[model samples]
Target: MRNIFIFIIFISMLFVSLSACQKEDEKLKGLVIESSSVEFGSLQNPEDRELHFRVQINDYGMESEQEYKVRFIIQDAHISDLIATEKIEVPETYKTQLLRNDEARTIVTGGSKEIKKDFTIDEIRKIIEKDEAVIIELYDKNRTIDREVVTTFAENIKPLVKVNPNAKLEHIKLKETNEIDIFSRAISDSNKEQGISYIAYPEYTFSLAEESYFLWVTENNGRIMNTKDTYTIYSLSDSSLKEVKEVIDKK
Candidate 1:
């Protein structure tokens, strides 16, 4: 009789342990992300820009509500922008853990996620282009257990233009002689069939001596239309081409 009682007690304990283990296993089941992309327009200057994203864990079974921490990381230096780090909580009901005696205490399984952002053409023209890596992370409360995620964003590689060695032209036309048009497409190629190709306009005021004009033109885009050092002089008194040498001589 004593032996039988001991055997019965052991069987009951085993059943209880197995039940607890099953409950905990059930809590680690589901995962989700609320939103994948967040946009940051025109950060700092017109050049700096960024994007944000979030990942959420969900549908975990729990006796009471609990919370989990989340984080972000940038893995590839060339692809992503590391703007800032963020943390969020996952509710207990959305997370699960097994009983003390259960072999499966907590089970969380998911794949790496991704988020992306890009620069506009105008923004690319204003800044130097380079590749960068971005990463995101999701962490537990103590920050001990963290899941790192990574993705890449391509940098803009368009050419830009700036004015250098400013020269004064006499009687410039506001409509036809606009500096914006002149500098922007100053490095464009003139083709009879296509007219002009891959030309970008400048975006600054023409100044004297101290100011330098700079422009970016690439063969891939097109060739510069005009290579003359002097400006065309247009006047009602004499509508003729005068060498810039003549103007500089007068100065």
Candidate 2:
């Protein structure tokens, strides 16, 4: 009788251990890193720049009853100095809510939920610009971790500048004129084909400030199209185009 009781107790303990392992395995069943790489275009200043990313975790075993936290670490000394050291957390309620949403369904395929957050890319650029090495580590709530490395190169670091083509046309006026000429050129070599080559000459009211008008010319088939360049000239003084204080064309 004593031997049988001892044997039963040992079996019970073994079963419990196996069950615990199974539960943990289930928690991480569909957990995966969707966009591990965080890209920050170019950092001209030391001000902090952040890049957002998503971590996809699938709960195949059971509904998420607890929230999960994620932490970030920069192992390299040079890289660490340039970036802010911080860890981000995702609440359980937030995860649960997303899991129940339709959009979350798209991120969590085969029974999973995706949690997205942003990280500092500016910090990484600062370190790299100085010819330093960067190591990025992402830690999950369950202690699972992932990392990536970025090396400093001449091609990888630069300044961020964009040409806003949607800028408003200044000094517009309506006049009866034939054959209005619109001049446009490609800013980049690759954009030579994709660049705007068409102009639109409206017969109605047609007058705009020289600064307000942006000539976007494009070539179609074998002929040049000018109608594409003609658009309702927006006012630079308006709130929509006010943020666009200026438009700079490379060519």
Best by TM-score: 1
lDDT of each: 0.33, 0.33
Query: Per-residue lDDT for 55-143 in model 2, tens only?
Result: 44333322444333433343555433433333323333323333444223222211111112322334445655444343333344555
Let me know the TM-score candidate 1 reaches against the reference structure.
0.30
Q: After superposing candidate 1 on the true structure, give the runs of residues whose Cα lies further than 4 Å from its correct spot.
A: 1-49, 59-68, 80-136, 145-251
- TM-scores for the candidates: 0.30, 0.28
Where's the lowest-lDDT run of ten residues in candidate 2?
Answer: 183-192
What is candidate 1's lDDT per residue for 1-251, written digit by digit as tens?
A: 99999999999999999999877665343232222322333233333233433344342332333444444444433233433223223333234444555433343432222224332333322221232233343445555333433322223222223224364323222233334343333322232222221344432222222323322223223222121211111111111112222222343
**How well does candidate 1 score on lDDT at residue 106?**
40
